[model samples]
Target: MIASSNWKRNFFTIWTGQAFSQFSSSVLQFAIVWYLTDKTGSAMVLSVAMMMGFLPQGILGLFVGVFIDRYSRKRIMMISDSFIAVASFIMVIAGWMGILSTEVILVVLLLRSIGSAFHNPCLQAVTPQIVPSDQLTRCSGYSQAVESVSQILSPAVAAVLYRSWSLSGIVFLDVIGAFIAVFTLGITVIPELHQDENRGKVQVLREAKEGFQILRSNKGMLGLVLIGSLYTLALMPTSALFPLMSMSYFNGTSMNASIVEVVFSVGLLFGSLLLARWGGTKNRVYTIIGSFLLMSFSLFVSGVLPPSGFYVFVICSWLMGVSGPFYWGAYTPLLQSNFEAKYLGRVLSLASSIRLLSGPIGLAASGVLAEKYGVEKWFLIAGGLVLVAAFLCIMISTVRNCDNR
Candidate 1:
C-alpha cells in the first residue's frame, strides 16, 4: 500500500502522465472522425465507426474484470497502454502509405477500444489502493477536471494540426503519450490485491458471475446502477443532438455550435474544480440527486426556448455540463467506498457496460425522433425521463442510505 505521506505524490504523478495520454488520444480521435467525415459524408459510416469504438468495452466489460482482479493490475495497465501505442503506430504507418482506408481506420479504432477495455478498469481498480478512501471523491473530481481540460483543448488543437500536419504526425503524439504513461506507471508503486493461490483454478466465467452476484446481492447499489443507466438513456439523445439543436432549431452557425461546446466544457472544468474543493455533501447521494434535478431543469428549459433564445440555450448547456461532475464525481466514489477492492473491478466494469450499452440505444432512437418530430422535442422527453428517474432514486430507501452501509 502507498504510504499516507506519499499518496499525493504517487497519485498526481500517475494522473499527470494519464492526462498527457488522454489529451493525445483525444486529438487522435478528433482527427479520425474528421478524416472519416471527409472521406464519407454518410452518417451511417460515422455511427458504425462509433460502434466499433464502444462495442468491445460494452461486450468485454463483463469478462475483463475477472482478469483485472486476478492478475497484476499494474502489468495490465502497462500492456494496455503498450497495445494502444502499437495500434496508433499502425495507424501512422497506414497513413504514411496512403493506404489508410476507412476499413483500416475502423480496425485501428477497434484495437484501441480493446486496449481501453483493460486499461480503464485497471486504472479505476488501482486508485483506491494508492489514495486514501476519504479522498476518493476529491481525486475523482480532479481527474474529471483533467479530462475536461483535454476535451476543451483537443478539438481546436486537432483542427489546427490536421490542417498543418499529416494525420500520421498527429497520431504519433499518442505514441509518445502512451510511452510516458507506461514509464510513469513503471515507476509508481501500486499495491496489488491479495489473491488466493487457488484463484487460478476458478473459471473466468464463474468469477465474472460471482461479481454479478455481489452486485445483485446489494439491492441499493443495483438500484443506483439502474438509475444511472436510465439517466444515460435519457441524456444520450440530447447529447447526440446538441449540434443539431444549435444549428437547426436555433438557426445558428457552426461558430455558435463550437461556442456551445466550449462553454459546456468550461462548465465541466468549473464544476470539477468545485467538487474537488467541496468534496460534496456529507451524503454524496444528495449531491447526485441535486445534479439530476439541475440537469433536468436545464434540459427542460433548453427545449422550451425560442430560436431567439439561443444564448439562453447556451447557458442551459453550460448548466448541464456543470451538473456532470457532481453526479459522476459522487457516484464513482460511492462505488469505490462501498465495494471491496477486489470486487470493485467487476462492479465498475458491469456498471460501465450497462451505461455504454444504453448510450447507443439512445443514439439510435435520437436520430429517428429528432428527424420525424424535432430535435428540441427529444430534449423535453429526455428531461422528463430524468426527472422521473430522480424521483425514483429519492423514493428508494436503500439507495438513499447506500453510502452509510
Candidate 2:
C-alpha cells in the first residue's frame, strides 16, 4: 500500500494533474492537426510537423530519463508543464493575431514534445516510488483509464468547440488547461527523494557512462525492451493507417475517420478496464503473445474483414479492442514488478523513445503507400508482418520466459 500522505499528495494529485494536462494536450493536438490539414491540405506539411514533434522524444528521451533519475521527478514534471504552458500561451496569442504559420506551429509542437519527453520518464519513475509494487498494475490501469477518459472527451469536445468556437479557441482552452495542471501540481509534494549515485559524480559524462554500463548489463530487462520496441514497430501501422483506410475503403466520410478513432478509444477503454479488474496474474508473457496474435489475426484480412457493413465493422473493432487489455495488463505489470526503482525511468524512457521514434515513418509511409496501391493492401502487408513477428516472439524461448525474472 502507498503511504497515506504519499497517496494523497503524490499519486492522486500527480495523476489528476497529468490527466488534466493530457486532456488539454489531446485537444491541442487535434487543433494543430486539424488546422494544418484544413489550411494547407498538404500531407507533406503534416508529415513534417509530425516528424518534428516526435523526433525529439525519440532522440532525446533516454538521456532525459537519466536526468529524471538524477534529479527530482516532481520538479521535472512541474517545470516541464510550466514551460509547455508558456509555449502554448505564445502559440495561442500568435494564432489570434493571425501570425501563426505552419512553421511556427511545428516549432511549438516540437518544443512541447521536448517537454513531454522530459516529463514522461519522470512521471514513469515517480509512480513506483509512490505506489506499492503489488498495486502497480491496478494503478497503471487506473492511470490509463483516466487518460482514456481524457481521450474520449478530447475529440468530441474539440469537434464541438471547433464548430461553436474556433481553432484558436481550442488552443486557448488548451493553454488554460495546461496552466490548471500546473496549479494542481504546485499543491502536491513528493514525500521521499530518490537519490542516484550518479548525481554526485563531478562530470555529467561520467554519470552517463555509468548509466549506460548499468543498462547494458541487464539482459532480461534488455529483452523486454526489445520485445516492446519490435512489437510496437511491427504492429503500429494499422492504427496509424486507420484514417486513410477508412477514407479509402470505408464510407469515405469524415464520420468514418471519427468511427476509427472512436473504435480505438473504446478498445483502449475496455482494455484498461480489463487490466484494472484482473491485473494480469497468470502467465503474463503468454498473454502478451496471445494479445499480439489476436490483433494480427484480426487485421490479416484479404480485402476487408468488416464485410462492408457498419455492424461488421463494429464487431471487428470490438474484437480489436480485445487485444489491448491482454497485452497492456501483462506487459506493464511485468516491467514494474521486476525492475529496480532507480533504473525504471531510464529503462522506460529508452523503450518508449525507441518505440515512438518509428511511428512517423510508419505513419508517413503508410499514407504514401495507401495513396499508391490502396489501403487494403497496406493492411494486408502490415498485418502479415505483424503476424510473423508474433509467431517469432511466441516461438522464442527468451520471449516466452519473459516473466521468469
Candidate 3:
C-alpha cells in the first residue's frame, strides 16, 4: 500500500515535469519549422528537416527498448532529458556565434530525436507499473490533455518570440525545461519490474527476437501494428506540409500559422477532457477505427476546399486534432493492457520504431509530391489512403476480433 501511494505521487510528479518539458520542446519545434518556411519557402527543405527529426526515433527505438527493459526507467528518462538539454545548449551557442547552419540544426534535431527514442518507450512502459488497469484510459486522456495544452501554447509563444527574440533564446528555454524535467525525475521513485530469482542471465538479441515472435504469434496484434504503420505513413505528409499550406495557400503570416495550430490544439484539449471524463467505450479498437475514419474524412474535405475556404480548413484541422487523441488514448491503453509489463518495453519500443519508420519515408516523398501535385492534392491523397487503411482493418478478422481477445 505504501508503494502504491508512492507510485501515485511519483506519477504526478514526473507527469508535471514532462508537461513543462513538452511545452518548451514544442515551442522550439514551431520556431524552427517557421524559420525554415520563412527562409527557404521550399517544401523539400521542410521535409528533410522533419525527416531528420523523426529518423532517430525510428532507427534507435528498437535498441533503446531493450535497454529500457533491462535498466531503470527513471535513469533512462533523466539521461535522455539531459542529452536533449546538451544538444539544445549547443544549438544556442551556434545561433549566438551566427554560424547556425542547416546542418547544425539537423544535427541537434537528430540528437533530440535520439533522446526521445530512449525516453518515450520507457515512459509508456512505466505507466502500467504505476497506474491501475481501470484508470489507464483516463490517464492516457489526461496525458493527451497536458500535451494538447503545450501544443496550444507553444505556437503562440514561438510566434511572439520569433518576432523579437533570437532562435537561441527559444532554445535556451528548452534547456531550462529539460533541467526541470531531470530534477523532477531525481525526486521521484519509479518501481522496477523484478526478474524471477531463478532466471538465468538474459540475452538482448534473443529477447528482441522474442518480442517480434510475440507479435508474430498474435495475429491480431500484428495486424494492428501493420495498420498503425500505415496510418503513420499516411499522416506524415499532411502534418509536414501544414505550415507550407498555411503560408502559400492561405496567404498567411507566421502568426496566422500559429493561430491555426492553437485552434487545433484547443480542439485536442476538448477531446482529451471528454475522454478523461467518459473513459471511452469498452471496445477501444472500434474507437481507434472510428477516429481514423473521422480524421480521414476531415482531411479529405479540407484538401478539396478552395483557398478562400481557409475558415473551413480551420474546422477540419480541429476535427483532425480531436480524432488524434481519441485514437491514441484508446490505442496506447490497449497495448498496455494486452502486453505483460515484463516485455512491454521491447514490445512497445519495437512497435514504435516500426510505425515511426514510415514517417521519414512519407516525409521524403511528400516534398516531391507537394512540389509536383500541390500541397492540397497531397492531403487528399493521404486522406484517401488512410481511409482505405482503416476500412481494411475493419474488414480484417484478425484485427477486428482483437478487442474481444
Q: Highest lDDT: which candidate?
A: 1
Clashing pairs in 2: none
Displacement of residue 268 (Cα, Å) in model 3 is 1.2
Local distance difference test, per candidate?
A: 0.90, 0.71, 0.84
Could you give candidate 2's per-residue lDDT for residues 51-87 as a string of tens digits? 7877899888757767776676777888888888887
Q: How many clashing residue pairs appear in each of the predictions shown?
A: 0, 0, 0
Clashes of 1: 0
TM-score of each: 0.98, 0.90, 0.90
Which structure among the candidates has the greatest TM-score?
A: 1
Residue 50 in candidate 3, Cα distance off native in Å: 1.5
Weakest 10 consecutive residues, lDDT, candidate 3? 1-10
RMSD (Å) of each candidate, 1 decimal:
1.1, 2.7, 2.7
Cα lDDT over the full model 2: 0.71
Over 6-72, each residue of candidate 3 has an lDDT whose tens digit, in order, gives 7668778989999989999999998998887787788678767877887888888767777787778
* Candidate 1: clashing pairs of residues: none
Residue 235 in model 2: shift from native, Å? 3.6
Q: Is candidate 2 or candidate 3 better by lDDT?
A: 3
Error of 3 at 210 (Å): 1.9
- Lowest-scoring 10 consecutive residues by lDDT in candidate 1? 195-204
